[model samples]
Target: MAKLSLCGGRAAVTAGSRLLASGLGAVAGGERYTNNFFLYDCSSAEKKLPDHKDEDGLAMAVGSDTILAHAFSSSGSFFALTDDNKRLILFRTVPSWQCLSVRSVARRCTALVITTAEDRIFVADKSGDVYSFSVTDPQGEARLELGHLSMLLHLAVSPDDQYIITADRDEKVRVSLLAAPHNIVSFCLGHTEFVSQLLVLPWAPDLLVSSSGDQTIKLWEYVTGREVQSCDLSTSHRQDGDEDKQRFAVSRIAASCSGSHIAVLFDCVPTVHVFQFDAASRQLLPGQEISLEHGVWDVAFDASSGLWILQEDKDEVVLIYRLADGKWQRSLNEESMERLSNHLRDNWTLMEGCSDTESPFRNLYKASYDNMAHYLQKKEERILEQKQKKRKGAQQETTQQTKVLHPVTPSS
Candidate 1:
């Protein structure tokens, strides 16, 4: 069998397979088991054409605060998700959609990635220890691999399989030999804040790309741990001095398969910064900036197809985007560059201002607050408000949903 999953689980962590393999019905049978692993026959599930009008992409219904992180194997066949419950659920692609394993760790699982060669996985916890689990027997005891001083933000394995690169909350990226993780390779230094994501360029295996809460996207050599280039993106997305009050940090960053484009996402901002990757100069040049209706929670690129997926805040579905003319834009094609620009003028209505009466207050991006579902939910409440407006005295009971405690991270 061609294993679609890379062995170790880390950022660039493969969580899904683009190939929905055919001829799935031949082995379609009742429930089966292999060494306690449940087999899934995807063909057996009642299938119907998905409605286009419905929300698109692989939508995780987990509340915004509940989902910590999601990863796909380097091969994209296997998918894994770590939730607030500290449970890691692994899913298989070929032959069927089945839950291969569910491992409950002692502490919160922070980051994970599949290895390039073997089919095993590595998981990092908030407590700073790394553990390896074999996909074949994931529930079997996990072997402790390594540990970090601070909370690990992200990790990635080198393409040559010679080393493992890990980034922590305290602005450090450690390089260690894969075979002997305790043996240090070198440290890729100089990130002032927490590193959010790491990418080993596919086209140039020697180059590594990283984004950080320090408001920078940096490139470096993972072998010698030498800085190649760095770009401060604080002013790249926002222009005027008006943005001084609100702090902007890098939430996520992703690179394309060919390493031609890079995606940058920030906290509380609805814009996606597109940077053109200069493989020759080992630099990133500004390209396009695509603004969404809401801030992005996470971003992923499909290496096989060259498409992008964005998880937006307060949205039930993951939005699918595409690269057009060297820039990342909405895949739906309904929102053009003109439309995106129009949003700045028409959609953003300044409602809140500072007491100084002269200082420019933050722009309340209306799209973030104008949620369609929220509006419908408030329709009945609006009717009640009108009724209460007329009635002498009417009791109003507010229904509250328990707020899920979001994971605390250096970057987050």
Candidate 2:
């Protein structure tokens, strides 16, 4: 297997493969060049935004029906994507992404991680259960491991395989012994809301970084339950004005493989903020912000060369950007994503339609407040019409009474 050198600080490199934007494996290990290709606007932030082919200037689109979760192995030899329908597809990433096996879980899988040893794969689901399976297991039998009380939002294993770190929606980061997951080491509790993403730096095993719905990111040493640092970045707000700005939360975060750069992003947002990570001091410095062409769902970047960005509006789920002159720039052309590809779940249809009684949204009210306002508006209009009618009728009656009282006996 050929390895891509991700270390020159910021040097020009070459591309071994045209990045396939739909898969996560390519950017995880693919060789990219910093040749300053004219295809994409390099450092578009430094100047005015330029008009590109696609709206928001995105290169390509991956039009999968629905993709729930995706991840690449530690060695970058394998990649997997979990469909919204609970089917998990594994791919061999070395020569090319070849479909290895497919397994369907009972619930929607939220996160996946391959062990540092690269022998096992673990997947966490929204139902709070974590399952482990062999990497090469064609059967794809997911064995049950420890479980959480709330929905498992993220998963991470220590470099030495001593502890398994799991973040839950209940704002708790639990550290459990992998060998006996039932024996939890400690709970890193600081976030006020749901925990969304988790990362333990490869070079610094004791340090852990986590992002959460409380619109903040925190660094912790899980074994000792110590909070090292925290940053408030929850700026993305709901445009509808129905929800609070902090509700957007810090959902997705990626650190460069070299561990020098950390990127943070949010769901339904087109902007990304990069932070410089000082490995020695274990502190994160705010860096430049990159605006994308469309709303993005997730983002991942290599420490040295490339970033895998997933967009929501475009058909291409994954977009590649290469590091150039200390700044990450979009390099891979849009044509690379033009060719339509079939994923493992390409033939599967999103299961839809349900009886009113069985619908999960059955109890959901359609903003009865808004409806009540409309109702009151109509009621006021009706009342005004009735008042006008009564006034007209009273006028006619008064005129008739006057005539009767007058006893008009003349010309009329």
Candidate 3:
């Protein structure tokens, strides 16, 4: 299952699979679950659908569409999603949620970013290429923007729309000119593993926040490729497990519009770490740890700075927390929460085989193998065996000599 905070936190979207027992559905489901997309407007306490001309057909066809990446334009006036079908779907959200266009991508997309201009959307695919599509011209052909040697994990655009930031499996954060992507601006280097998430601060356009499989969240001056600060997740204490010794990849990072708060969620970990951004000191200070009853899937900070969480619980899949008296308290949009949770619970079966999907971060971790040490140990064993063989041969020779010398005595 996957979830995204959308429409500047006024809405959220969750993706899961629905079990299909038939031919095309079963083939589309493959080893993964079938895509069953749900979009909820938190403010209105209702679900929204893509206003496609053939809305009914779109709903039926989406059962096989596994969304690989999605992002909302900086202004939240536009939303975009890419799927395994190699299709990019754009939606306009200003007046009402409606499908703007559906275009084909070069390859299976891994990440997406919409420029602040709201005119173009950038898509990163598993083949290590980024493609640009026009938001204004729905039928405009996709243009090849840039290429990476490794699969791109995430993409972020500068608020000014001058620079495009991309993170890849090679642990590189690249800053490139939006107009001329071939012109490299700088590279934000330091992460030793795959960079999974990237966010250009909404409030501080110059500041870039990135998370990695290396178990660290880094802040960067993206334009200059300078790392500002880093928070290591290994040191975080979680009461439930030996988390201090365990390493977890940062799956999501979200910052409040006020720039005062940042929320981070570690993959497979049930706790959310809220960090206070000290603008005065230019520091990210540890703030609060909100432990959940079940494993968390995703987290986002709403426009009001409220934290919304999607977790593993079937009964309560959606959780919203607000800061009150310096503590994070559960704030219920009871009706809204119920509707969202029910939608997930009713289709929980679609998420059953999801555990079989290999986590991309797992391979990002450096593998340790001591080939030299094994070779040396085998060499030592061979030397010991040769020594024993020689000893046995020497003993047999001595026995033979004794028998030859004592032959005369035996005859007498």
Query: Best lDDT goes to which candidate?
Result: 3
Candidate 1 lDDT by residue in tens digits, 1-412: 0011111111121211111111211111242211121222222322232222214665333222233455566654576655545556677754444567766554567778877764667778777788777776756767788899878878888777777888887788988887888898899999877777788877778888887766787899888999999888877656456766443466567766655776776655667777777756777788877766653444545433233433332222235567667555555532221232232223222111101222111221112475788888899899988887756333222212222344446774
Candidate that would win on TM-score: 3
On residues 88-149, what C-alpha lDDT tens digit does candidate 2 reach at each position?
66666545446676666656677887777777777899889998878877555878988987
The order of the candidates by lDDT, greatest first, is 3, 2, 1
Error of 2 at 373 (Å): 22
Q: Please provide, for model 3 over 85-110, each residue's C-alpha lDDT reduced to its tens digit, 9 standing for 90 to 100.
A: 56777777644566777776767788
In terms of lDDT, model 1 sits at 0.57
- The lDDT per prediction is 0.57, 0.62, 0.74
Point out where model 3 deviates above 4 Å.
8-10, 17-64, 237-244, 334-360, 385-412
Clashes in candidate 2: how many? 7
